[model samples]
Target chain A: MRKIAISDGDIQVSTRQLPPEGPEPKPITPAAKDWMLFLGFAATVLTMPIWLQPLGAAYPDLLQKFAIFGIFAIGFNILFGLTGYLSFGHAAFLGVGSYAAVWSFKLFTMNVLPAMLLGVLVAGLFALLIGFISLRRAGIYFSILTLAFAQMSYNLAYSVLTPITNGETGLQLRGNDPRYIDRAFGVESVGLPQTNLFGIDMSGYPGFYFCAAVLIVMFLIAMRIFRSPYGLKLRAIKSNQNRMAYTGFNTRPYLLGAFVISGMYAGIAGALLAVTDPLAGAERMQWTASGEVVLMTILGGAGTLIGPFLGATIIKYFENIFSALNEAELASAFSFLPPPLQEFAVTIVNPFVGEGWHLTLGVIFMVIVIFLPGGLVEGFRRIGRLFRGRSGKRTASQAEVQPAE
Target chain B: MDAILLQVLNGLDKGGAYALIALGLTLVFGTLGVVNFAHGALFMLGAFCAVALNEALTWEIVTVDPTRTTAWGTPLEVRQPYLEAQFGDFGAFLVDFSVPLAILVAIPFMLLVGVIMERGLVRFFYKRPHAEQILVTFGLAIVLQEIIKSVFGANPIPQGAPDMVAGSADIGAWFGMAGSIIYPWWRIVYFLFSVLIIGIVFAFLNFTTYGMVVRAGMQDRETVGFLGINIQRRFTIVFGIAAVVAGLAGVMYTPILPPDYHLGMDFLVLSFVVVVVGGMGSLSGAVLAGFLLGILQSFASMTEVKAILPGIDQIIIYLVAVIVLLVRPRGLMGRTGIMET
Candidate 1:
């Protein structure tokens, strides 16, 4: 949650008439728009390596993390950003999916395809059971119950299902777990033997590409949904639940559908994580972890399609890269400084930079909440409007901020 | 039977904790119309106060009196502390039976904490949306935890029971729990103390004029305001009262779990769940649900549910919450008033 700076306001707005029913939302802008979005995505992807190259050589594994969490946030935004219904229990689905994927890989085969499918299926099932009951209530009650269930799942994984989840050590295979189909690992190509594309050796860069391709496909699918009828129904639900109910639409199915879809997306993200790491732990479903996704969604721009992805990247960047600075690293970076000055920098920052990364994260979250209440995307929009407003152009925010009396 | 009885006592002790935290949560929610996620942190602060007070009382020197040589007709020395000078004499005495005495000190200190917290952080939230309220309080909780961790370090302080209440009681000679339900004296004392606190809080709320006015304000804030009453000030006081309840709960809980910074995070989850089960803003409902869930948790982990599901004990409370929500969305004792309005 972003910190919101508040003060007593003297101004209050009263509307003489309710908003008129607008025409159906423009379904699809055009194919040209789609091409432009694709071009922008391609440009971003291509330019990532310029900044990533230096750190990628040192810790290549961390680069993949930002992408994975970005996918998770994107999936989360589909429901929370669009529907106006916050689900704090979404991480439970992620946990279930991770475990399910890992188990499937162990029991059935290490083929990434089957494991990912199993993860999605299992998470969807869990979501169905929880959603059936949780969706009965709306608003904050809904979020509270979801949070409780996530905690319960985490506790269960940590305590009761010790044999299955293996408690704190978490379910991991040193080598004993069976992997019948994957004779190799992941998706690579012809007889690589250690990596596999559908049983080709794929524990290399190719697998990374495979995941990226899947992300792009998912993104496209999400964009399509945003323009679809189901999406409109969700928007309607967000606008006014009673209006939809009186209009004779069974809102339950829509709510359930949105939930299950979001759960499946989280499942896929978790399954991907499991495939990459081959272990799943209960920590993924903790309340703090759920809160992280909420922060990511808000920080990036919840309602917008691309906001969560950007938010995820920022958080992950801070988590993996920003925290990588150590005393030696700081000293080396500031070698040009005077000896005493360099020493002071190292001593002052050594405690908080590396292991105290969470402290930094907490500070960042607080700052984001207090300042960018709507999030970073909103910040960008505000910036754009400021430039436009100065140039004597009309801006939507200006209209809202200074409504005509 | 012995194990079961002992577990039942354990359940009640835990229930006492839940009740303490829930009572605070209910008061805040009822009066301020905000869900405070940081209630657990306040409880932790109360327990930490015990540790802080205990550390302050140090008797550096003891003087000997040689004139009291009676029993053996020889010179005998009696020592007395000359320096109960600094922090306070009460704090010096508190170091001896720290946990119990801490409870006494924690009430007023916690009241101060309550008033300050309401005035500083929570007052601004009285008008915010529930999500914003949750966010601000959650941030405050994190900030509070960091400050405590910064000052006290992260390790759990080994607070001890008083000498008079040091060991487990011999129940076998007394009653139904004779061979079964022997509890540590300190735990039993804490539980009894909590019952007394709960009674006092209930009495204060029900039998007092201020309590009546507060309840009336909770029922209809606008109406109370229209009658020319200072509803905001009363709401702030209720917030203070809520803080006291949470702090006292923490104060007594010190000997059981020992005070640690992260203790609040562990307890807050279950306490909030208890609050939800009790059906938001209902005092009696919070207490009822706290004890009910505590006992059910104990029973579930007993050989009963384990035989069927193996880990039913871990998720039973949440599973039950789901069932309750499905059957009665308003919860077991939810009010007809609109929540999240």
Candidate 2:
């Protein structure tokens, strides 16, 4: 029997292929598979507001973060998971994107379209510059190179580029500053302008929907990339770059393309962050910020299509909900327990949540890395396999008994 | 000329800390093949050791004196540290020397912490990929930093040198420049201490049988194991030694930069840059690069240089590292193909 290897996102499965004399392998339609995935993704994202309420994550600000960071993690997964190249400096792009978006806001209009477009374009260009230098080296050296570049950018943003970045106070909207689009269009002054698309305000539910739609589009693009021939080359590069090199495949362009694309995605996410929050800070570009996205991607499942989204959702939930859980919330959560027990529980658990949320995150990430290297998605796959294997064995036994009869 | 000398001295002092930390990092990486991200955390822990010792040495006892009631009629409280109450002048002298004396506390604490970290968490990650090792260690670092933060609120706690070495020394007079150049006494001491430690480490590695085994294990782990030598234990001890070195560096550094929970992370990336630029697993290379980059950084921070290219000092090390790594992939002194994979 010949081995037929297939990959569905990050998960690879090998099946036995029968000889030509046997019945032909059942034909599978690629378009049908793509359509099914698209439909499922659309339904889940379109109904995020309705579904997320149960998880106490229906708020606009958080919902927007969920979508934005999902985009970021997905982008990161493309480079790291696909090519096996970990870039610690992706936050540089994310920060650059935010800076670009904020600049676009300062120069043009409050429209998020221009901001996002500019953010993505600028970030892509920056990524190209960094990726060119960084891609020259591989392994830990590559990681270090990217890190150094990102750090240089961060340090510059923090100190040197104070005029452009506005230093530590961050770039914020001003009443006196000339917004050219507002001038040309003769838009009247308001208290503080909100980011909008055409006329719809990007706040509350509207903002979440806008972010979700963008997330869906980004997810679709990621899915398309994962299925394309270029995607195959990326996977090949990850599996064996030396062999690919020997086979006359110039890997640099593919690597650079993936890096730029991922960087652009990060830029868009950064733009969305600014669109939702309306402020861009230098701290957004810090190494710790970059580390957080790495944590998200890894904790979710690196190679899987849905893993980044899941990871982003979980991490964002911790950042938003888990961090906000105070004594009162903890008391309410443990109300079912006796009063003394509840108090003890709150006291015990208090250190791992709220301001100590990072500690909890660190512990959880360590546990995940140690116990579940495949991440949360891998756990789901293990459960599925266990059940499927049991049922398949039962069916085979039943078929054997029928043949005996 | 004096300004240049001062800057050079400043660079050496900074480079000393970098070299010491990078030295330990290289030892751990070379011996265990695990990139101990928690290495910086060990340095922070070492500084905290000094802080802890200071707190312990200055443990105060308060007693209410009923005979001395004042103002609102509350009894006057007389406070005396137990050390002072017992030993008086000697206790005061001890408290003055607490920063230097904390080296005693740091060595054992760092060794213990290092051993536990290796046996407990890092042991599992040895056979794993570098990525996994990095992630696990990074997680441990976060956990460690957070624990420190929780214990001691996220603030820089200043630790001072003894009175004798508290202020700047007139080094210019010694050099015949006559007060044109003065340098901090503590900084000079720190530089000498680092040099001494570096010397001791090199001597230990070069002159000892254990060091020979370790060197052999670093070159070929399986072959050393085949020789029936317990290289694993030696490496674990090496890990402890590295931690102690890092800790000692941190302990001394508290006077320069106050001890903080995030101090580890602040230095970690820079230390890693130093290590890579020195060339991974290259001991003498780490030292050379550390001093080179350190001096360059100090020089870059000069008023003239900053005037020409603002904020150059903040990122000069990283910029140098990028250039060095791109131009010479094996680093300045790294043996080729060590960690190329």
Candidate 3:
């Protein structure tokens, strides 16, 4: 009984003779998008080692860093991208996690499982304490408070806490470090203890696979959270906390919740770092390191499920691969070009690689922030739209509305 | 008592540098509402300007001396500054005073840099989020630092004060306490210079018609615009002035702390803390808090304090900041409802 009419160059529906509603509009299953995104992310993670070999980033160390920092960025996105609380102190938790892991190794067995669990638990507790104080203020004040706390932590860790943090040398396992679990189990002392999970060595290919598996699990958890009702509430806080408040939502608890979760994620990342290298340094908690995570989250397209990981991978690639491009490597890279052209290219590109990699990163940061505020995710979306627009007979309006799904 | 006096003097001198940087930071924040993470870089550029001027004044003309040879049988190269060759004693004096002379160069350069940065980048970010402003400026700071690093390398380049002021002044002797309370002559000069510059900035802001308009714009930009004033243009000029102030501070500070790529970052965090403690957008508060924190830091660094607290000096400023934030929230002189959200 409904009539669809074209009026004023727009389609209008007249429902005067129709019923009010039609079977609840089929509920618009949100999990479909989440599941699709998760699968895509999983595929990428599983195949990165194989695919990235051509890009000269296939080393175990680089891959491990990618996975570890991916977790850091993902956790950071939860608090920053989703909730809009820009913390300058997440590194404090990361440092704490590392210290906790190393201390676990010193006191107990070299089993990474217990060490990682301790790291997460300690970091979560630390976050709760910090979040309690910092969440009292919102916006810039919140950022400043977090910064102050972090600075205090850094200063203490570098000096007053030297006995525990080992002053600038960082926390490392000594030969005489008490391994209570190993001693009780009647295991003899080796030259140097390495992190192992159920007798599987946490280094090289196996180590990467272990980290990759953990990353997938973490990613799945993040995906679930993104789809959950609580994540929607966090987004609501980001969009407009005042309105959310008027609707009887206590935003502070939710914000605190996000902060703690993110902090724990950083903790896990820190623990994994220790598992890979078995050392924890005070420099890990510096503000610059904190800033690095922010850059990664933003660069990868914060708020998206896979964007943080992508950002982490890209930044790590730059740090590891691009920074390693010596003059010889550059000359080899452009060897196919004519002699003059090759020299010219090397001259032009020389300042932005090797020791000048930071300059390249800075330029990229500025350009991305200025041009692509949504980061690489927005770039991908635009490319997707362009291809779809060319391949299909869809109208511009239809293409615009497609993202609403 | 003399030790206490000496510590007080040290605090006041340190406070002077902190106040100048924080004053500029507060001025920009008050007018433009942008948290300039690159302001420290501007200060670093100023220090480098002094370095550049020194290098320029000391440019050498080397010639092989036919009359002399080294133990290795190489010709002894006699080097004379090109300036000295041209202007004799005047060139030597100029080289000695290069740091002070560089103020002239730094002022115009910093102003231009500030204006270009504002117009080219910050102008677009006016309506954007503060986070974007921070991020963009942070990126700029990194680029600026890296550029300087490539040019200057990673080491701190030392700059010395003129020979006449290199030694400690017996200022206490004037008051019959010379033996106990001596301080560096250059530090006193630096302090006086800071006060003079601060006075000029205050006078400029308080007494002039331009200052009146700027102050009004700071209060209510739309109202000032409605009155037919170009507030945005004025704010750009203020940003330039802020940059100049920071640059001049850097110029003067070269003797106290050597110019380095990371110097700006080290000062920036502390200056931000000063601004917050002074209360955001309150120039007077920034000045007062700068001195207060500076003195407090000096006292915390005392051997006795160290004996008791054991490295409290390193964290005293941050600790005070945290406490101040918790207790006051608006800072020492922060206005109501600004940046509270």
Candidate 4:
């Protein structure tokens, strides 16, 4: 039997091609396979509210967060996963998107469509400016440059740009405002305005479905980008930028394009956040916020198409569900054991749950980075291989191509 | 002139902190070729070392005194610190000097933490990609900070300077200036202490045989390994020294800025800017860049500068970093082919 190797960036899976094992099987086209994957993903996401109920993440707010952060991670993955350029400031784009969307609500209308568009546009422009300067340097220099720009934006937003960002109180929808489009359309404001799509209120279940739809669309675009020739150039750059340059490929535009597109995705996610809750805060632009996206992208699997979304879901699940778990819940959960043993178990697990969920996240992230650099997808792949059996040679060959210093 | 001098002094005080933190960062980057995102956590740990020492020193001994009964007729409970009760005036002196004396505990403790970190976690990443190193270290940083949070309860634990140096001193009189320029005495002490630590680190690296081996390893690890030298051990030691420096800086900085769980993350970003401006893996560059940015920040915070450009101080360091990065990508003191990819 011969091995047929299927490669996705650094990850490779090999299956044995058995000689006429059965009646000649019809070949499945790559497009068909992609469609199947997309359908599976869509089904999983659409049914998250049902399947995630057991995990206590079925609520509207948490579902919306899952969708929003999933888009953020996917966008981040486009830049970082494809180009191997770790931008430590993508949260700036998210923040810009949020601010722009909120401003759109204040000045123009509360239509989610216009707000998302404006957010994407403004964030794209901001990314273009920052990326233009930052992409001049690569490696850690690039990371630092992006970090500085984000921090500068954050500082200015927090303190100096109060006229625009409303400083510490954050920009919020007010009862009195121009809302010119709403005024022009003769839509009377009776109370604080809620973001809507053609008069369909964007809150609770409807808001989640809206965000989920956008997330699905964004995922499709990301998948298309991943499979395109343009993606090939990005992967080439990631592998060896110097070689790509020597071969006369002006990589700046491609990198800038990826950066801007990803920025727009983050912007859309941010706009969705504002749409769901009509407020924008400068803290969204903080370095920690940027770091969260990075953590999500890396924890899922950087180069894989669906990895980031999965990572986002896991993290948001932990943030919302695990954090909500209190001592009473823990004791009840461990009540099967004797009283003293249950108490001991609770004490041991106490620091890793509730407000300490971040501690669990940190530990898990470290473990993944150390053992499974490709993130959860890699973990799944290894488990699959283990069950398949007699795949030692394939695994060994895979290890040879793994990136090392 | 007095105002300028005071700003300069304030700049120096802030610069001292930046320089100290960035120095350790640069040292680790140079020696191990590892970007330690947890360096700030080390500084925080150092500060907490002081807090822990103070807590241990002041373990209160409670006694019921029936003679001091309250209006409700319950006996009054009197509390005295165990150390003070035991050693009297000497114990009080020790308690007062706990912040400074934390250096004694922080050095060995931080060294152990550093060595354990290097041996346990960092060494494994030596052959991995820089991105992985960053992610792992960043995760480690979060874990460290979270652990600190769980222990300390998210509040800023105030650490006081000794009574002798708690008040402001008139430095303008000493300088023979017409106007009085009063500066906090603890800040001055912090500045001097940072200078001493920086000097010691520089001297150690430049003068010692072990440091020479570590420096040689930084230049080319493979070549040093071939030269029958155990450079890895020395690199681990260098990591330990770096931790010590950062820890001591944190220990001294508590009086100026109270120690909190998230303090490390706050300093991490700024110090990173310092390291980048100083040039990656350049020791002297880190120091020079640290002071330059700190002084510029101090000047930018001045009312005159603020009037000219609102909130320039908040972003001056980053602005300088951007300008320096754009104009000279190698940074102020960077060498060729080190992390240039």
Q: Candidate 4 chain B — worst ten consecutive residues by lDDT sum?
A: B171-180
lDDT, candidates in the order shown: 0.75, 0.89, 0.87, 0.90
- Give the clashing residue pairs of candidate 3, or none: none
lDDT of 2 at A117: 96
Compute fnat per model. 0.37, 0.71, 0.68, 0.87
Instruction: Give the candidate order by descending DockQ.
Output: 4, 2, 3, 1
In angstroms, how far off is B88's CA in candidate 4? 1.1
Candidate No. with top DockQ: 4
TM-score of chain B of 4: 0.97
The TM-score values for the models, in the order shown, are 0.85, 0.94, 0.93, 0.95
> Candidates 1 and 2: which is better by DockQ?
2
Cα lDDT tens digits, model 3, B1-341, are: 77788888888878888999999999999999998989999989999999999988899999899889988999999999999999999989999989889999999999999999899998889888888888888889889998999889889999989988999988678878867788998899888998898999999999999999999999999999999999999999999999999999999999999999988988888888899899989999998898899889999999988999998999889888888888888899998787765
DockQ (C-alpha) of model 2?
A: 0.76
Tens-place lDDT digits, model 2, residues A1-405 = 001123332221122234659765554445566778788987897788889889888888888889999999999999988898989899999999999998888888989999999999999999999999999988877887888988999999989899999989998887765779977898756677888998899999899999999999999999888878888789889878999999999999999999999999999999999999878998999988888888999999888888899999999998887788887999999999999999999998988888888899899889988999888887887676578897655544543454223
Instruction: Please give the distance, in angstroms, between residue B323's alpha carbon in candidate 2 and its true position after superposition.
Output: 0.8
lDDT of 2 by residue, B212-254 (tens): 9999999999999999999999999999999999999999998
In the order shown, the chain A TM-scores of the predictions are 0.81, 0.89, 0.88, 0.91
Q: Which residue window of length 10 is worst by lDDT in model 2 chain A?
A: A1-10
User: Interface root mean square deviation for model 1, in Å?
Assistant: 2.4
Which docking category, incorrect, acceptable, medium or high, applies to candidate 2?
A: medium
